[model samples]
Target: MGATDRLDRYQPLVLGLFRIVIGLLFTSEGAATLFGVLDRDATPAGDWPFWYAGVIELVCGLLVLLGVLARAAAFFSSGAMAFAYFTEHQPDGLFPLQNGGLAPALFCWGFLLLVFFGPGSLSLSGVFRRDAAPERRG
Candidate 1:
């Protein structure tokens, strides 16, 4: 097989690993900001917007990580990143590089990709799927 064929054969594995890493990183950010882990100050108990965003991040991140309703979770996560970038970063400058919006920008696109492509084979969704036919074959 050629390089493309070899890569295609491992697509599910690569996608799963990518999803896991993204989910973990996103979840860690929420945990750090929400609970004061990782030397970051917690969003005060009643700060509704930030607190709620963190909650969404944490929940969606976990869902994506577990591949449970992953596309939906990824859609929401992508929206959150877009909202954060536009509201917080865009106000400072038009470009991500100028405004330090790289993280949100990257996350927005990454989750958007997941929303379209899905969580892949090594996921709870795959295990619990009712359909007997496989979605892909190598």
Candidate 2:
């Protein structure tokens, strides 16, 4: 098969994988927030942040699973992990032994990888492939 044909053939597979990963992550996070596994005081200063986070996770997770706006959704997901890592995981120090920091850092790093690599040719993003050739005359 030609390059274009090969890419087209594999596009769905790539997208499906991306969708699965993003869906699972978002669903897991949403479940934690909604179930209060990651609990926090909903105080007067910001009463709804946790709730909003939970809802976003739930909805975005579903969207990612559907391969809708997967890149942007993944970016936000990555941002969430980064925020969590910086705020909660950095207490001990820069290294892994410090305050259970390694896991969060690694998670954030993986998210960043997803954001940058962008699910590759195995995504809905790949399905909407933009040809390199310049526009031609009608």
Structural similarity to truth (TM-score) of each candidate: 0.90, 0.57
Cα lDDT for residue 134, candidate 2: 60
For residue 1, what is the lDDT in candidate 2? 78
Candidate 2 lDDT for residue 80: 70
How does each model score on lDDT?
Answer: 0.89, 0.64
Residues 23-132, candidate 1: write the lDDT tens digits. 98899888977999988999986586678778888899999999999999999999999999998899999999999999889989999999989998788888888566
Pairs clashing in candidate 1?
none
lDDT of 2 at 123: 50
Q: In model 2, which runs have C-alpha deviations exceeding 4 angstroms?
A: 1-19, 36-49, 101-103, 120-138
TM-score (C-alpha, index-matched) for candidate 1: 0.90
Off by over 4 Å in 1: 130-138
Please estimate how well model 1 matches the true structure, expressed as its whole-model Cα lDDT.
0.89
TM-score: model 2 vs. ground truth: 0.57
